[model samples]
Target: MTRPIRFGHQARPTPDDDLDGVARRAEAAGFDVFLIADHVGHGPAPMVALAAAASVTTTIRLGTYVLNADMRNPVQLAWEATTLDQLSNGRFELGLGAGHTPQEWAATGIEFTSARARKAALAERIEIIGRLLDGDSVSVDGAYHRLVDASVPRSHQSRLPILVGGNGAALLGHAGSHADIIGLQGLGRTLADGHEHSVRWTTDHLDAQLGQVRAGAGERIADIEVNVLVQVVDITADAERSLAQVAEMIDDGTTTTDLARIPYVLIGTVDEIAEKVLHCRDHWGITYFAVRALDDFAPVIDRVRQLE
Candidate 1:
């Protein structure tokens, strides 16, 4: 069965531009969703920025690409999510993640925990957030978070969609069982003290992660929407040359053929990219694709919509 394709554009707002204009453009450009990155230094507060975007756009879905769980208490997050959903009139999707990027924690004076601990914390938080969003008063004395008779304003939607983003097995397993949308990211390996790396671009690595998700999901597997973040979409006539350039940039001694197999890097003309998208949908059941906002990606979005 072929799932309908949904394309999301990730916007990193700068201080100089009009955010409302950006949201309007995304809606006009045939993009299904407008997403914002959550970080302390680089981007604006995702919830605030998305709320502003929500005010200007009517149809486009507004969401955080993935909100780090460590940053906010689940009860507070529930309140903010409910407000955003109400403000957007049910066009908000909550994307949460086990906080990566240690620097963000350091800069904010938040304690940096081990990856395992963070993932465990995220699992508990997801449970708490889901209950609160569903209008159930929750009381939890979890390892990381404690909620005492916490309940939030009900969301506009009957059940606000929860999207969990991760590449590791434990997090993906949790997402499989809980999330409405499962965001497949690169392998959660730390590259540096403050930075992380994802092997998600590789087909084999992705297959392994998908296995974890499937095993964890069990009967609920059929209900989840599998999403991929298209980190690089290079639309060019010379696909080989573009692939080579990208491989060199990655500098992992990866060949062009190897890069061609990676789902995250889509290099080719619009038609070729569309073919690859269809192939992925048919083979992997990945229908949701997100790419960084770029002029080159608009045509690909248009093409994918036609495929849908």
Candidate 2:
């Protein structure tokens, strides 16, 4: 199904950045959504920061780029989600991920389980959280969590969107089955640093990920909105130079051509980048694109919208 093209700005705010002003700026910049990351050492708490953003902005939607499921209990997460939804006047999208950073778990004193275990727990949380957001009394005796007649306050929207993000086959498939949005970053295994990730931006990898999504989505494939987190956005005059730099940084045998073709990296002139956005939507059915910088990406929004 064809969905409206949406541009989200993921704020990587430091202590000096004015939270309220950032939200207002994103809204003024014509972004569809303003999102923050959920990490122990990085930005402020996702829900709290979003609440602050929601208070100052009138139209732009507020969301977590993704909350680490391993760090949160399903019930408490659901409660916070509902509160944010009401406070935002129904403009909340809960983006979740199977936690990947080992340092985050260690810092918080939360056990960092195996990747398989974390994915399993995340699936269970998604089920529980989605049901609770819909105002259903959930009673589940699962491996990760157990709830008896647990329900949260109803959300302001009849159906608050749940966006599940990851690059793994299992996570993508589960998200396809249960989530309203599936966020793809074209990322693979976490590196030794625990913060960085190996790249999975090749055509073969992307096809495999989409195949998994389709496999799990089945008849519901058309109902899901696919989103890609643009890791790099460079509107450069010298495309070859920029592409080579990006490819070297990725260090995954990704060629300049691959970088140019992939939706996760935008490197070209304004018009060229704008065409890539259209190409992504047409070729992959990807209508939602989120980037890290607002000013850098602001120019492409109107261009892509007009092209669409």
Candidate 3:
């Protein structure tokens, strides 16, 4: 099957004008979904930014690339996510992760823990989020959160897909069980040595995680969807370089990736990017394009539309 493209934006220097402009153009362009990053102190808060993006457009799906669920209070996040779901008319995906950034945790005053503990806590948070979204009033005593009573209004749409992001065994397992969609992430240190091992490792990890998820959800496993991405930094337009980066993602286990498209980040013309997109899709079966660092996403958006 031909992979469909979902454009994600991580434009750090992206101005509000660019944000609205990109959202308007992206909606018109037919790119499947548009995602915003959820970081501590950068850009507009993802939920609010997506709310704004939703106000300007009618159809393009909006989401966080991956929201740090560990940091967000489940009760508050449930309400916030449902609110965004309502505002977006049910076009939102909630991506969650147990990130390793101590700086962010330190900033939030969130307690620090070992990697294993962190992953365990993240799993509980996922369960809480899912239950709350499903209209159950929840009271949980867990390692991380202890809520007395929490619930959300009925989802405006069908079950909002919970997109879980992370690569370790526990993280992947958390996704397989609770998340409707799994965000396969990069686990390699560099992009030069072909991402083959990483991909295979991730695929294997998911297989293991899937077992846990299947056990947890019982009959609900069939309803889940798997989504993945490979992140990029300091993009250049060179086709070989870009291809290498994308290929690395494929090798690492990401069936999809963010296309780096900053003004000077990439070296080639729009035509070259189109060629690269075709190459990635044809060979690697990559279907998603979460854009990186691009100032105005118009050029990249147009290039993506041509594929459809």
Candidate 4:
């Protein structure tokens, strides 16, 4: 357990199994956390689904992969996060984001604005949520939302981890300003550089991003956590075959591999995935990784348990 790799599964909107079953199996399979992919127009509510996960798994931390800040109410989110943290024995990590996805906004009839505006709104919302979590009466006025002495002064946990999800230069500021952990997105498998015999710089950019997150983090930066979610498992038998399978998935729209042009979807055997991830820990200085398990990734999950 020297590496302390934590595993989590994507709670698909239309999962094959019941929520309880999915949560139980994930915990039984040695996953340390369970997270849902959050989207408003097309997907289920991440927190609501996580409630079921919390009911079933006692030890595993429960939270969202990344909840869109634009679509969520800070008041409700503050309550939900604290209540779940208590229910799960104080193991909840909140992942918030600046909203994107025009298709989703169109579906919901919500006006989508420039990225800069969204970032500002997200920053304000995080500050509000943090204050409420810390037992303070919050009053604020912003371009998006306003609160006057808004209070949710009760909380079950003293502290809950809030994560900002995105890699845009605009977001690094908020990650530094408010987030306890910053999530780097990993998907769309069109990584043309790493599979070949080139010295990978994916590790290099990750190091730089995490460094920025650390430097930008002012007071809370002291013990900030860095997590990257990578789709690191594929169905094929060998390394060559798995990489090819991942290449095809990139073509088929099942995986995304753009962490500075490195395949975040590390496609290979358990040993291969471990070796690939070690680069993140050793080279990039990123220690916490949340893996998105695919259908063919059962073997990798089994292999991760062996490491444990």
Which candidate number would show the highest TM-score if scored against the true structure?
2
lDDT of 4 at 55: 78
- Provide the clashing-pair count of each candidate structure: 3, 0, 14, 7
lDDT of 1 by residue, 1-308 (tens): 55688889888888777878988988888889999988787767899999999989899998888999888889999999999999999999999998789888989998998988888899999999998999999988878776688899999999999999986778889889988999976555767766658354567777888899998899999899999888778888999999988887777656787678766878999999988988888888898888885566778878877776
Global CA lDDT computed for model 1: 0.86
Q: Is candidate 3 or candidate 4 better by TM-score?
A: 4
Candidate 4 CA-lDDT value: 0.68
- Considering TM-score, where higher is better, how would the candidates rank from best to worst? 2, 1, 4, 3
TM-score for each model: 0.95, 0.98, 0.71, 0.81
TM-score of 2: 0.98
lDDT of each residue in 94-159, candidate 2, tens digit only: 999998889888898989899999998999999999999999999999998878999999999999
Tell me the lDDT of candidate 3.
0.65
How far does residue 223 in candidate 4 sit from its true spot (Å)?
1.2
The predicted structure with the larger TM-score, 1 or 2, is: 2
